[model samples]
Target: MGDRWQVEVDRGVCIGSGMCVNHAPAGFTLDSARQSHPREPETDANEPLLTAAEGCPVEAITITLLTTGEAVFPPEE
Candidate 1:
């Protein structure tokens, strides 16, 4: 666990598309609700995680740099 990044899933915004799971199964899973959820919020920063977040059709996944408190995914406004 590098603990440098914070990954989150917005269940309300998730469309249950399973793209995140397909991209990064170790970090994301589709719960019984069929929504994507984080299994390891502070896992080592990786490319798949970013890809998973970016690939979300609904942009439900959010990845933030813990050190800087800056969102790396979903392109924060």
Candidate 2:
């Protein structure tokens, strides 16, 4: 376990592509509306989470370090 992170799925921005679910099923799932949502809001620094975020075609998933408020995935400039 490394830095704690808050995994958030922007349903408004999501396109129900399922890429995140394919990359990290443990972290995300599809809702009844066919939108992607996090199975767990808080999680450790896991590769799957990063992969899920990176795999999102619409870039709707956001992984942020809870402690420092830093955006990890879709990395900030």
Candidate 3:
């Protein structure tokens, strides 16, 4: 099976911080007022989505790999 990664952000926990967007622009973006949601193109397995997740001060990002059911969290500084 092809590999895929799913990303999720907890809106309630999101603090309108743009760190994720800044860290992984290709994988994330902020709304007009800097509200965070998943990016449209989707995140690549090797992309910096993990970094963005770690950059989030609120720890609101979650990444799950579909094929192996593996996951990465809290990007390392």
Candidate 4:
């Protein structure tokens, strides 16, 4: 099996830019309040998901290894 990631969006930092949705419409969604959210909190690692996290303007998106809780996006640096 491939790496599985846990995706999260910091609503406090989100600015409703819709960048995530634009990058991965099937992976993310914006709520009525325009807050970013992951369509599936735990999902397989994929290019679109990674792009969505990387493209977030506010760096509100976070991705971690589902099994070990290791940082994926923004890394540990």
What does the lDDT come to for candidate 1?
A: 0.88
Relative to the true structure, candidate 1 reaches a TM of: 0.89
Residue-wise C-alpha lDDT for candidate 3, range 23-61, written one tens digit per residue: 888877777866788884344675577788878999988
For residues 1-76, write the lDDT of model 4, one tens digit per residue: 9999999999999999999999999999999999999999999999999999999999999999999999999789
Best to worst by TM-score, what's the order?
4, 2, 1, 3
Clashing pairs in 4: none
Greater-TM-score candidate between 1 and 2:
2
Q: After superposition, how far is residue 41 of candidate 4 from its true place, in Å?
A: 0.1
Winning candidate number (TM-score):
4
lDDT tens readout by residue for model 2, 17-38: 8999899989999988899989
Angstrom error of the Cα, residue 75, model 3: value is: 9.7
Candidate 3: clashing pairs of residues: none
lDDT of 1 at 25: 88
**What lDDT would candidate 3 get against the real structure?**
0.75
How much lDDT does each candidate structure score?
A: 0.88, 0.91, 0.75, 0.97
Cα RMSDs, all models: 1.9, 0.9, 3.6, 0.5
Sort all candidates by lDDT, best to worst. Answer: 4, 2, 1, 3
Off by over 4 Å in 4: none
User: What are the models' TM-scores?
Assistant: 0.89, 0.95, 0.76, 0.98
